[model samples]
Target: MIAQRYSYLSWLPLLLVSSSHPQWPSSWRCIPQPARSSVPCYCSGRQTWAGSLCGTLRIPGKRKRNEIMLRYVVALSLLALSWAQDCQVANINVMQNFDKTRYAGTWYAVGKKDPEGLFLLDNIVAQINIEEDGKMTATAQGRVIILNNWEMCAHMFATFEETADPAKFKMKYWGAASYLQTGNDDHWVIDTDYDNYAVHYSCRLVDADGTCLDGYSFIFSRHPTGLRPEDQLVVLQKKTDLCLLGKYRRVAHTGFCESGTSLDPQ
Candidate 1:
């Protein structure tokens, strides 16, 4: 049997405010509490009426249900507003006039700010290529240490879907086998020098509190040794612009992926 989760929302005071009350918060409104139920209710910003004194207004007949539905509609609207605000705050500016041709090549991940469920440990290297049909594809190899301290080389492949903006792409990626990584994620080229260095950003999930719950960013360089002094400063500024300055750690490429000892079956 399914329990009515929002039934407790019927206890709220569904007051009809007069136009004379001028100081009311524009975004705040009274919503009806649901009827009798044991299921707990929760909302963003601790807005739930649970464990609090909830007053009720006596509205007879169909008007009662209508008011309850209205409350739900308003709640959903506020949630959408919060989501939009989070996106605006978290957005990072991508490259302008980004040429996929120039960007295609083997690039090394010199630094990374990993998100939740990070699979790539170190020695991260990616080879980007443009297909005959002009589609962009990538193959990434990295060293990963999983549960019980088990270590292996992770080989990943990704196909990019172009957006209206040249620098923004939706990446669908999967590992060589089913036991490895798989997901569709945003892949934004935040800023890239094409040949020397590049900054990448991706936000996986946003919370109702107008914040990112999960996100990842990378600093890539053409040379295996790492970015030059001039390029490093440029990358730092771009990182600051993306709100990820000082949030990253250096990713070492010390032939860990090249070694055969931790190799996975192809």
Candidate 2:
């Protein structure tokens, strides 16, 4: 098996030589076979390695074939990296010894990863309050489009139920108005500094592979303007840890909700 793996990586020398080329031919293609397939060969008629196989790649000529093989090698490397990420929702880590007292305050949504059928569009702000009994509840305001494209500021409320993990909570949320969205969600505090920024994640659906099928995330900041320059890198690393680095969009605040008549929860 080791010898076969070494033979497979022998193409790396050619890949290194071609790395300096300005452009690769777009006509090259590499289609890998299913992992469960019993295929006997790989690229260039080589035996399959690591229990995986590559399907026949189409190229116009010998030069294009070599370039395409280089791309195939890069694709394999990326696949390996993705597998190492371990995106299983149950395996994801959260903050340790979370303090709800310090977390209670106004948080502006600087960035968000919307789930399917996103309700909130922008100008999102959430206020967390801890009751006298040490229970956590929150209210949020955001601009949303309702029936027949009627845009309005949505006021939502949520109550958190404690769990075995301090950073993880079961959130029961509802809208101030009956027409808005309401449901239960898993609220996990991925990371936070309790003063500058906070990262929150929720998975509404789980796939068979133990990965998040449908989910949303929020990058919260104490200031509505945005995260501090020093906090940006830390938040970026937390986003990467959640496997949602590039899936977020900036949540803008243009005073849309502030101007509305909706009562802000106190």
The C-alpha TM-scores of every prediction are: 0.65, 0.71
- Candidate 1 residue pairs in clash (backbone atoms < 3 Å): 7-34, 7-35, 8-34, 9-33, 9-34, 10-33, 10-34, 11-33
In candidate 1 the C-alpha lDDT for residue 172 amounts to 96
Model 1, residue 6: displacement in angstroms?
Answer: 57
Residue range with the least summed lDDT across 10 consecutive positions in model 1: 13-22
lDDT of each: 0.72, 0.79
Per-residue C-alpha lDDT of model 2 across residues 1-266, encoded as one tens digit per residue: 12233344543443443344426443433346753355543434333342333343332445654666778879999778767998889999999989999999999999999998747889999999999999999988998887677778888999999999999999999887876778999999999999999999999999999989999999999999999999999998888788888999999999987676453443
Q: Candidate 1, 136: how far from true, in Å?
A: 0.3
Clashes of 1: 8
